[model samples]
Target chain A: MRGITITLASLLILTLISVVFANYAHGYMVFGILILAALKFIGISFCFMELKKAHSFWKVGLLLFLVLFMISVLFLAK
Target chain B: MESKILNHKNIYYPPGGILIWIIIFLELITFGIALIVMVFYGQKELEIFHTSRLQLNTTIGTINTLFLITSGYFMARSVSYLRKGQKEKSSLFLKLTMLGGLFFLGLKTIEYYFKIEAGLTVGHNTFFTFYWMLTLFHVIHVIVGLVILTSVLVGLRKNPSKVAIEDVEASAAFWHMCDLIWLLLFPVIYLLF
Candidate 1:
């Protein structure tokens, strides 16, 4: 419960930080944001959802899917 | 063969809820792809993206995030309650989750109206296009989640026993994933625009 609250707090702070200077951030900063986003998702999946209990095949499948999808999106991106 | 359930001392094998997990995973993959494409295409218009960020109301975004987080907490609690055979508490939480979904959609609609009035249409530019598309895509998922949650709630009320509690948990997990994605997106689009 406490952890969930903390996550929510951090999310708010991040949103505020972005709103404060939403326009000036460059690719480097965007990359940092992406990392933060990925980390948050990982926390929820592994910590909260207990992905460890899930089958190894499904876990691998998810990782592979993300990788491939991201690559495709970047490949076709403007 | 007697009843196979996860009680105080009896745990079932090969839980029948695995299929739902696969569905959630697939949906996440689709959303992730869309996110990457939007960011990639809109990279050149980072300036407009930043300027437009000011137009969005961060407070609303924060509120929605908190609402979803609370829902996630309730979802986790409801699962625990289910394991303990506390049906009423579990159903209540499920209903609460649905309410959170509705609240988010309402705020999103208001946000959209504000954006349209501010001359931030999807076709305005690459940045605005991605902004509207990505957020709306997310909104669609939220709607889907709300529908699934409503079904679960209705089932819980009519015949709680027939409804697969684990399946409910799985749906809630996907809903949280959607929430987490927006937690990242709201800041990236609105704050840093």
Candidate 2:
């Protein structure tokens, strides 16, 4: 419960930052914002979805998916 | 043996189940491809994309993001409550989660109503095309999620003891996946412009 609240609050903050500079933020700045989104994604998966009790392989796979997907989409955006 | 893999206290199977995650990954890939294609089109028609993007309500998108997150939080609370054997509290949270989803749909409908009134439709332009496709598709998922949540709630009420933790967690996993997809979409579709 505490963890979910903290994650949502942090995500809201990151979202505010991203929207404030939506026009000007470029390249790595955009990537950084997306990385934050991915972080929240991982957090929800672990804490909310109860992936913390999941197997090691699932955890590693999710991390790998986040990294690879973010990098690919950013490249495509570029 | 088919219920859920639980032997020596180590999780070999996923929270919801292996099947749901497979469905989730497939859904993500579908949305991902659509988004990538949208990006490529945006590059080609940058002016049209930007102009159409300006027509969208960023505030609404932001609010919807909060709605989804709050609903997800309620879902997590429900799961925890169930784990503690608090069926009634868990049931209340499930209803709250569904309320969150319904509110999101209400706001989304308002946004769409304004867009349609302003001469923006799926066939309006490339940007509107992507807008309708991505968002409407997402709306369908939300509906599916509501169904999933409703079923889980009913199951809990019928027989909380029979309601396995894996079963509840599976429903929760599907709900959170909806949240995750929107989180990915909210930034890229709404704010990235």
Q: List residue ranges in candidate 1 displaced over 4 A.
A: A1-28, A60-78, B1-16, B191-193
Count clashing residue pairs in model 1: 11
Shift in Å, residue A56, candidate 2: 2.8
lDDT of 1 by residue, B115-162 (tens): 899887999777777778788888988888788777877777888778
The TM-score obtained for chain B by all candidates, in the order given, is 0.83, 0.92
Docking class of 2: medium
Model 2 misplaced regions, further than 4 Å:
A23-29, B1-12
Would you list the clashing residue pairs of candidate 2? B16-B170
Error of 2 at A7 (Å): 2.2
lDDT of 2 by residue, B105-160 (tens): 99999999999999999999998999999999999999999998888888877766
lDDT of 1 at A32: 48
- Listed in order, the DockQ scores are 0.26, 0.57
